[model samples]
Target: MTRHPVLEARNLRLQFGGVTAADDASLSIAAGERVAIIGPNGAGKTTFVNICTGYLKPQSGSVRFEGREITGVTPREIVRNGIGRSFQLPQLFLDTTVLDNLLLALAAREGIWNTWTPLKRHPRRDEMLDLLEVIGLTETAHQLPRELPEGMRKLVDIAMALALRPRLIFMNEPTSGVSTREKFAIMDVVIRALQHNATTAVFVEHDMEVVSRYADRVAVWSFGRIGLEGTPAEVLNDPDVRRGVVGS
Candidate 1:
């Protein structure tokens, strides 16, 4: 039997007026692979993720997941189809408890009417709790997002995405805005949780430490396209990658 790539992008291009955010970018990840996309500040990393997650429509190219061509799917459709994403900045209803947030994501994953109706104690709730435990936030499940530390809040956002039971996840700067001490810890929890469940993770990160430690492969984007794709050690040490980060 032939196994298919969990996600794939073919000649993806995202342009804004005369500016090209991402141009002719192509990549693939197999099931359970933990890959990192690394580049300098304006390397179009997030633009690639936005197009993949359906938040932005690319001017050209195609995105396919699990053999289905979903070039211009809506974010709702993408999530429903088993692709979930976490924002660079944690996007949470600040007043809501962590439990409620997870429940909301679960409800959304289950569909529309289910979200409005009172959430019943179900198997999914147990699953959410298990995820909370993994992210080290189970003890704070009743706390509101504002009460948690930045790292924990990031974890909560990730947990919310995990509740959707996605096959692939796109994370934009997963460790961005986090302190150096907590950055690696945050990535550890997120990577471990996803890999434990056989989910493919594609994250855009500026921290080479996290990339070296967690990424099974690294793709360096430069000049609106991919400069190199290989094992972390291979890509990171490449002269082109070094020049891209310093020169771009």
Candidate 2:
């Protein structure tokens, strides 16, 4: 049985002045699959994500989610349609506690425009706590973002994204700023949480170790296009990828 793709982008083209960010990019992501997008510094991996997530409108292309065309939709609209994403930097309310941050995200997900409203009767406390537990941050739920370490901060951001209960999530460099030793720890918790929720994931990653361990499939971007798509081993060992992406 063939499963339909949860997200699909075809013939995506985007440009920023003279630089071509995405050129004829196309990809399909199946439900519950973990995909890693990898390439060198300016290969357009993040640009493609921005386009799909509605942050950047492509000059030309079509984006479909769950069999519906979503190109040119607003970010909030796309998120409401079951797509969510976490940024490379942890996007959180630094002044508030981790728990409160998740609460706000939940409120926003429900279209509660008054974020300042009292959360005493927010009605989603248990759900937020479950998300904290999934990210292994239940102990620090009461702490503010600044008080938490880098890795935990990242987890909190992810937890907030999960608060929306998105069917598909895009993670931009989830392990970027954390120390090497803590990278796997963060990814372990993240992958486990995704599986627990049965959510599909697409992440832009530079760490080959992380990609080999976590990614079920890999997409290699080069000069604004996906030049290679295959298993981690296949993409990692390819001579072209080795030279262009890995800088070997």
Candidate 3:
């Protein structure tokens, strides 16, 4: 049986007045693939993710998830159709405990009306706890976001995104703003969690080492378009990518 790409964006063009945020850019990611998008700052990596996830609309072209056009769909609707994303900065409820944060995401995922129901009493609370264990954050579930370390907070944001049960998840700079020592450990947890859920991942990454370690394939975004696409060995080793994108 033939299977369509899990997500495909073709010939996308979005202009921001004089600057082109996405200039005739396109990409297709297969199911179960870990694709790392590499580029310098301002290279339109996030623009592609925003377009696909319905946070930003493109002036021209199409975004298809499972062969259905999702261009201009609301972000929530996109998520419903099996897509999710995490931002560069950890987006967490600083006032709430880690467990509650995921419970909220689970409520949102299942659309639970909980005005009268306590979150801990939700039927899916066990699932949330299991998720916490999967990400190795079970011990910290009672801690508030402000009380957790930055890396744990990042994992919580990722766990919330996973609560959506998306077939595909876009992670913006998954390793950015963390210490070098923590990057690999964080990525290990994330990739393991994704594999556990059978989810595909597309991450915008500036760290070449992280990309090389985690990505099955690499896409080099330059000047609002994809400059190269191939295995990490192929794309990461190219002269241009090494010089301009990798800055090594």
Task: Give TM per candidate.
Answer: 0.93, 0.96, 0.97
Q: If both were scored by lDDT, which would come out higher, candidate 1 or candidate 3?
A: 3
Q: Model 1, which residues run further than 4 Å from truth?
A: 1-3, 115-117, 120-123, 246-248
Model 2 per-residue lDDT tens digits across residues 51-77: 999999999989999999999899999
Measure candidate 1: CA RMSD: 2.2
Pairs in steric clash, model 2: none
Tens digits of per-residue lDDT, candidate 3, 1-248, equal 54458999999999888989899999999999999999988899999999999999999999999989999899989999999899898989899899999999999988876588888898879999999999899999999999988888889999999988999999999888899999999999999999999999999999889999999999999999999999999998899999998777
lDDT of 1 by residue, 1-248 (tens): 54468888999988888888988999888887888998877778888898999989888889999989888899989988899999989999887789989988887777647534576464468878888888888899898999988788888888888888899998878787789999988888887789667788999888888888998899998767888889998987878777766342
Clashing pairs in 1: none
C-alpha lDDT of all candidate models, in order: 0.85, 0.92, 0.92
Error of 2 at 10 (Å): 0.4
TM-score ranking of the models: 3, 2, 1
* Candidate no. 1 TM-score: 0.93
Candidate 2 versus truth, CA RMSD in Å, comes to 1.5
